[model samples]
Target: MTTVELQRDLPADPERVWRALTDPAELAAWYWPERMAPAVECDPVVGGAWRIASAPDGTAVGGRFLAVARPLSLSWTWRWDGEEHESVVAVTLAPTAPELDTPDGTRLHLLHDGLRPEDVGSHREGWVSCLDRLPAHLGADGSERA
Candidate 1:
């Protein structure tokens, strides 16, 4: 199986970052395509169901939460609308160094595993765009000065 991994540092604390990931409202604000009217439902607990409406189609895509460790990590199954196969996504958050020039923030590590080789590139691009939007959602812009 192919895997996609991404890491990003944001000028926000772990708790704030955790909320952004687990909270449906926060997710709706930045998770979906910009042109789409965001619609999301998330149950932030292990085994809970989550769903997000896809752009232009309004079809929902989601799965159950596999793991939920508040302010630290989360893992879930992912399946798009009409797709039978499922992939897995895991996110881990940790505190960044305060001693560094950057302000105290959280480091986010994301792993998307169990993808078909052909799906890897698209998933990677989608994830990169999503991650790039995260810091702006947090009002940090991924900067130390934020």
Candidate 2:
């Protein structure tokens, strides 16, 4: 299995980043496509089923929360039913200290694990696209690392 970790320094605060990650509206603003549902409905608690459906075509992504540490960390099962694909996505938000070299902002660490070699390219591309849109969606120009 292959794993990919992506990191980004967002200009927004931890709470804002958390909201963007968890809140339906904020999440759609960045992560969801225009035709997709504007709001995501899911019980974020551990073992709770989480589902995100896209509009127009109605393609959906399904998963379950494996862990939650509100505003800090969230680990969940991720799957794409149309493609019959599954993986684990763990996200962490951390506050970095003020420094000249370091970007002063919230750090978003994403770990996408258990991907097959053939699926790696697609998964990486999807994440790259997602992160590319996050800055404008959050109203902040942040730097992302893949």
Maximum-TM-score candidate: 1
lDDT of 2 by residue, 26-118 (tens): 676778666665457677689988777776766778789999998889999988766766889999998766772335567789999999899
Off by over 4 Å in 2: 35-39, 82-85, 100-104, 140-146
Q: What is the lDDT of residue 97 in candidate 1?
A: 91
Clashes of each: 0, 1
Which one is best on lDDT?
1
TM-score of each: 0.91, 0.83
Tens-digit lDDT track of model 1 for 28-129: 999876688778999989999999996676677899999998989999999988899899999999998978544778989999999999999999998999
Residue ranges of candidate 1 with Cα displaced over 4 Å: 140-145
